[model samples]
Target: MRRRKLLAGLAATAAAPLLGSGSVQADEALLGELLVTRLRDAMLGLGTAAAAPSSPEALATDFTRALADFDACRYASLAVRLPRLIRVGHALSTSGGDTEQHTLLAKTYLLATRMLVKMDEQQLGWMAADRAQQLAQSTGDVLAVAESARQLAVLARKAGWHDQALSIALSAADHPDLRGTGRAGAAVRGLLVQSASYTLARRGDRDGMRELTDEAAALAKELGATLLRDHGGGFSPLTVQLHRISAENHADDPRAALDAARAISLKALPSVERRSRALGDIAVTYDRLGRRSDCVRTLLAAERCAPQETHARPATKTLISSLLVSGPTSTELRGLAERSGVLV
Candidate 1:
């Protein structure tokens, strides 16, 4: 009954905007709560798998589609697919000792962790990350393991465990299996290093953050192209610049963040997710610098880039709320807050 209610609510939320309800704002917090609960139940082995067993080949195709939805910032579609995918992936992994099944399950859980983190469900995020790490290690895939570690690091950092987050990221970056594994290995290593650098920035270690950022940039340069691996993707110079925006923002260098933002263009990013993320960073940085008009404009641009991300991400919602009550407002800002379901 509870699961059905939650799923129904999610369905309505996803459909409300598309149903010509121009003034309706989906309750993103309610959506997150429902999703986290559903995901937690699925992770606890409480859900029934599909009646018919799916072939590994079939499951692979489904997973690829789900991943594409994630990459394209189709959060509504991805959220609807994730719980069932996790259940099926769990069933297949337990049915046999197939490393491929385990790998797929790990990837599923890793994707769940990412979503949970974006929604700021840190406790559930931790659970998903732990499961991903365990399953990835079981597969003996170094890149998979490194990706899981990166997610874990992100969760830890969000939970205020800065040192632990840094340790996890740096350790994964230095993993022996990742060494000399060519471009793929370098890409994963770059992600880990970038994650660690952000952790350092969060800890107020500006110098350390810059040093590690440079290291990650070097690896990105070596990759020569934005390698879109099964992992989180975007291990290129552009991505490094994106990360720099957030890092500088964290380090109380809003000017530097804006400078980094100037180096990026939405058209050059690999996916809508990255583009919206970049715009969100720029928006936040503008808020930091008291550029209210710029902040609102950038946030609107982010909404244009990926409405799902702008409407559903917790940080974006908070920023909208902040803009609403911070002082003078505009028609566009109010409309954005209304669309994002931010309570004024």
Candidate 2:
């Protein structure tokens, strides 16, 4: 009994600061409490009347701005705005009195699904995505349907349904809506193809992944002159490059990943979230490559790039936690991890 107590004490002591201390925001639920509270009020139908005054066009424009904020990894800001957006958007859907107004419902749901995923509410995310798919299909909005599929692929990936995720993404790529020279068509197809590339890389098919990424890159390059409304400021040449680095990392070839990372021009990634994600992928490569100090530096850069996302994202936090567990105890590493809210 004494020996058992001694071992328990040592184990608890070792894990204490890492798990129980306030050094990390691992369980902060960056979006969780806000979502629950706002959504709960919305669910009770308390907000629909006040939100009823929203026009479909106004809702659409606002949704785009929200998407921009989301893409920039401003989750706290988004969390504050989205509940009201959903309330108003939902009211518009039922009584906006036009096809155009109805279409925003699907778009809004897609955004909601993406946000829910970021909040790690996978089940609610899937429900929102499914709602988007149904609404898109009913309104004959192929582009919205494709967006729904993209979110579905994300949920599948989160659930560890890799092959299924790839299949859903590829199916979206083959959409009849993709057969055009329009910017929207190119952007949607490119984004879907790029998403599939990551799944392919995860499955160890580097060649197949590269083929898809190159295809996306070409499409993005061809449409380089402007953004598309389908997914405004959507998948671009720089976004493809970001995916290429991430795919290489997913394939477990840290050397290749590092090489690809070096090739990307950071300024080209316009949004804070994209830049931070690219940096995080680079950090992952450094971590895998056993360049502990470099990994720590890269992660610090990522946090500086997007503090909200760096703190909220599970993958980023997990990487930091792993570094803390594996790295030598040092002021630089520990201090960075603590500041990033991934370690105590």
Candidate 3:
């Protein structure tokens, strides 16, 4: 009886954060949270079991589910909850007899944490990335470590540390394990090269940037990888917008940048938040190209599509402000604002 009570107490404690009460909609949220909580607990239990007698396959399953949840709720604060789970997963794989499993798990954690950082949850993401990097080194997982270094490079660039970003990116590109690891997919290698190239370009190493980008593009073509596929041409959607922005920076023709932005906007329209962001970017690109009419039209379209949420209002306002800034506004712009019921 005591044991049973103790187990029940542990279960309730684990589940408390996910449980809520109120109306039907609240219950749905509670249910979703509960499901995520239960998955997290199961992952913990699997890790414990693996520690006793390592089971790489079970650990992989648990990590996959945890990853899915993390990806789904990345925009929220749920990304902060992933590092501990990743640590347990890394432990399970490293302790197990499967070298492949160890390498993959370590790399996945590193990549996922990097993605979380790009989502603007920098602190938690960096902590997780740093932890994954340490674990990868401990396990002699050089490829995983290189990948983590690449992530750190990108983060440094985002934080305005251009020189540091360039150095780290070069290091990632030159890592022996990264060059030698057959386990790492071609797409991953392409991204690493592409990132290195972009960083070089930002640092004004034009020849180096061209050489690297050319190499990356050729490799991507050889691997049958699209340079502008969904989710930034990688497996994750985290860098989709960033990739477009980078491509625009390097594009010789303004139309190329406009095309890239349009592609992203088309891909993002299914999600309200992403749609608003993509539209705003498109408007900015048009403004940069001196296409004031195009900019105004796009902004008007964005305002119409934007949801009435507090988070979306600011972006809407910015678009409106931009439309007003380009003097001698088009009748089409005024017509759009009036028709969309935004002119009050």
Candidate 3: how large is its RMSD?
8.9
lDDT of 3 by residue, 3-36 (tens): 9898888856654343122111222213333333
Q: Mind giving the per-residue lDDT tens digits that candidate 1 earns over 104-151?
A: 888898889888888888888888888888988877877778888999
TM-score of each: 0.89, 0.81, 0.56
Q: Highest lDDT: give the candidate number.
A: 1
| Each candidate structure's count of clashing pairs | 0, 0, 0
Give the lDDT ranking, best first: 1, 2, 3
lDDT of 2 by residue, 240-294 (tens): 7778888888877888888888888887776776788789899999888899889
Question: Which residue pairs collide, candidate 1?
Answer: none
lDDT, candidates in the order shown? 0.81, 0.72, 0.53
Model 2 lDDT-worst window of ten = 17-26
Task: Between candidates 1 and 2, name the one with more favorable lDDT.
Answer: 1
Q: What's model 1's lDDT at 62?
A: 74
